[model samples]
Target: MKMFMLKSLCLAAIMLIAVLTGMQLASSGIQKMKGYEDPNLETAVSFHEKDNNVKASILGNDISSHNIAAKKKKLEEISAFNFFSSMGKKLSNGITSASEKLIQFIAD
Candidate 1:
């Protein structure tokens, strides 16, 4: 019994150490990437801005106004989507909790 207890404690300690080490490694990797910027994204945005400028100049329109309107529309769509998604999640959680309670009550 003593040997079994010792082995179990050793195993638990080893597992704890392994988990902590893995977490530290993962956090450090994430920290290193925090300041990393995607070259592709930067290039794409640059190209888009240049294209908008050319188009606006050709058509004699203000590019800033068009960009602002586009950005506003995009933000509104994102906000609406997030609101509906969060509501759906809450509804699902409520149904799950209710069902669990009902099951427990019936079991009792």
Candidate 2:
């Protein structure tokens, strides 16, 4: 019984160490993005159903590119018209609201 418990504890510790190491490595590498990512399938499908294209494109563009060249390339590649139209209109109207919220949130 003592040996079994020791083995289990050792295995658990090893697994925990591995998991933490992986998390640290991943965290230090490319900073995982935050905020809305529209072109993502989850975002696309959700907004696509509602026909909101602007939000999808802008968000998708933002998600896909961190720089000007990348942005243009991503924009060209992201040709999902259904999702684009659906998100675009919403994005256009919501930009002010979203920006305000962002500003307020950041300030907070």
Worst 10 residues of 1 by lDDT: 39-48
Query: Candidate 1 residues 3-106, lDDT tens each?
Result: 99999999999998687567656655765677774443211111135644543321233456678899999998887557888999999999999999999999
Across residues 1-108, which tens digit of lDDT does each residue of candidate 2 receive? 999999999999999868756755554343445433334322211123245433223223432224668767888999657887888989987998999999999999
**Model 2 clash tally?**
12
- For every candidate in turn, the CA RMSD to the true structure comes to 17.9, 22.8
